[model samples]
Target: MRWIAILPVLALAACAAPEAPGSERVPAARAIERPFDVSTNVDFILVDKSDRTLTLFRKGTPVRAYRGVAFGDAPTGHKRFQGDERTPEGRYRIEYGNPQSAFHLSLKISYPNAEDRAYAAKHGLSPGGDIFIHGQPNGSPEGQKIASHWTDGCIALSDAEIEELWQTVPDGTPIEIRP
Candidate 1:
């Protein structure tokens, strides 16, 4: 009887215990205070896959640049079809923002615009979609670094960087993904 009464106290203590080192818990979202104004919207986004860079531009002037961005495993040429494992190369748009993403926050990219669909249809293949500029996978350890290109067909940035980009880049922003 006494042991049964102690169970609730032990459970509470366990709940209050500090997380283990290198825990895979998703970090809580914190307000990012940057030197630049977060409200300043970026007019364009340029992704250079060969150089592994993502640059944000306002009025045709570069405002911010993120280097060492990750891409799909293949990481070369335009995405041709579903399961190509290649990031698309061409102009697209930031269609929407996803606050509840499997990989932290994400900004959806508008892929398969007419031409892409026609190409895939010509070959009788599916033009896979759901590409985004996103952060690390959900529940990834804080500050974990990606050593190689590892996305399916999307661009990836650091969590903090994605948070900043999410705030500065609005929907309908033109994005050019270059080979």
Candidate 2:
């Protein structure tokens, strides 16, 4: 009789427990492994800085949306010079994929396009390159706590998210990062 009386208290305690950051509360049995088909035709990618959402689109239709994206440590304004620590807001393409990136997985963004270079040259500043959309920081624990913004000047997603992206996104896909 006492055990039965305490069951409700234990259940309440479990309900009150805080969920991990960046995790969605869903039943394990009902969780879908791959929310969207990677092989589906994804035409473009959009990153809205204000919303911190990276959405994949196919023919102007949203296919998948990944939330909880983090930007650079100093995530205000456009990156104009080297070591700005700010994500550049511009139109870019997935130039390549780095299977050997220090980050878990990475897809290179074609920064410093002709316009970017011209703008930087006009200002006599170096438009730092090597921008990417990648996974977590190197050597981070699988369950490492992620903050809203923590990167040099790149777009960041969870390791699992990047892995899925790596498989889904292909080279030359257009990405528009909007402030």
- Winner by TM-score: 1
lDDT of 1 at 71: 97
lDDT of 1 at 10: 94
**Residue-level lDDT tens digits of model 1 in 1-179:** 99999999999998996854422222111212235566899888888887788877677656677778899999988999999899999889999999999997999999988999999999999999999999999999998758689999999999988988989999999988888
- Residue 164 deviation, candidate 2, in Å? 1.1
Worst 10 residues of 2 by lDDT: 22-31
> What's model 2's lDDT at 179?
78
lDDT of 2 by residue, 1-179 (tens): 89999999999998986854422322212213346887765778888777777887677656677777899888888877778889988788999899899998899999878888888899899899999999987899995638679888899998988987898888999988877
Q: What stretches of model 2 exceed 4 Å from their correct place?
A: 1-34
Give the TM-score (vs. native) of candidate 2. Answer: 0.78
